[model samples]
Target: MDPWLSMYDFTYHLAQEIAEKIHERNRYLRNGENPVKINLSVRTLLKRLEESIGQLRDSLLRSVSTRQITQLEGDRRQTLIDELLTKERQLQMSFKGDGTEPDVIRSSLMSGGGAGPSPYNPWVLEEPEETRGLGIGDLKQQQQRMIREQDAGLDALSNIIARQKQMGYDIGNELDEHNEIIDDLTNLVENTDTKVRNQTRHVKLVDKKSGSCAMMVVIVLLLIAIVVVAVWPSN
Candidate 1:
């Protein structure tokens, strides 16, 4: 098999796989099943698909670099690339919402009602209600509901932040009060230490004066005793 043909087939099958996965996801949503599993599976599949597309693009570039494709083959390869791009667009539209209705409605709204379906997009002519399995009105309603949910989430987050801010302020005030109390206690301790030192000095001075007075009293008593002995010398 030609390398280009092999690459084309790979891309074509990968696109089909993505489309089928989209359908599966839609079915899960319709059934009101837990979307977590489906979402995880879809995400994994999409990653693989993107990697495969990159590989395909690189392979085409390598062929061109090697001058492997004839002029006719080059044109065919270009057509294949176009088809892959279309499929990729379709896959993206499917992921955005209930298939392509959102994109179609958006384009129509943007064009101011002057836009018609293009010949290249045959799927665009198909009734969106049928293809997407939902009316445009329903799609709009879903979008509005999603917006309301998002608004509610934002409000909740804002409330939480406000509460946290208030708590932070309260904590800061408490810390400041504690610091002030610590400073006051420190000053009180220093004043007490100074008073204690002054009292110790005063006590030591009083003790020295008492000792000097005792020595003077002893000297006076000795002089009186000597005088009495001299006056009684006749005995």
Candidate 2:
């Protein structure tokens, strides 16, 4: 059953009782002049009551989440993961690419057999003039440039990729949790609504009885008037 609806039920009945009392008090007001103040303290009381309930609501919601998660087993979790992946893919696709190409220059420099040290395996620059016939000075300058480029490239890539990965994981978990929560809340709300409808039907039944009683009273008065008229006819 929905804890929220149960809580609301408690609160609603209290409000109804207070409203009935207020109505009864106003019914006896003399001359219908200078309306009685409804004791604004009622508002303060409700506010405090809401604050107290809010704490309970929070605790209950957490408990619901935990129960839902626990019920969610391997298949469910996997399904949730798949759903999350689909959403993540859609998000990735929605972002229009800025058309920036990969760092090809850095790629060539980092690859083996380049004039510079391998980025993945940085080593002292061997004199290339003796092998590939490229001047050592030119090779050294190129190596220095490649090294700087690789350093900058690595720094830029590290944070962006890491942050994106982290965000994907976080969003997936939250979505799964949120879905479970909605399911639980929906069930609870449906049950509460059923109860409210039942209560309303009961109220209507009472009103119908009251209306019938009022009609009977009216009919009796009319009969009395008819009897009085019939008896006065001789005068």
The per-prediction CA RMSD against the true structure, in angstroms, equals: 14.2, 43.0
> TM-score for each prediction?
0.49, 0.27
Give the Cα-based TM-score of candidate 1 against the true structure: 0.49
For model 1, the local distance difference test gives: 0.69
What is candidate 1's lDDT per residue for 103-186, written digit by digit as tens?
454343233223564444322233345336665466667778889999999999999999999999999999999999999999
Name model 1 segments beyond 4 Å from true: 1-6, 9-132, 231-233
Which candidate leads in lDDT? 1
The C-alpha lDDT values of all candidates are 0.69, 0.50
State the displacement of the C-alpha of residue 176, model 1, in Å, after optimal TM-score superposition.
1.0
In candidate 1, which residue pairs get closer than 3 Å at backbone N, Cα or C atoms, i.e. clash?
A: none
- Residue 52 in model 2: lDDT: 40
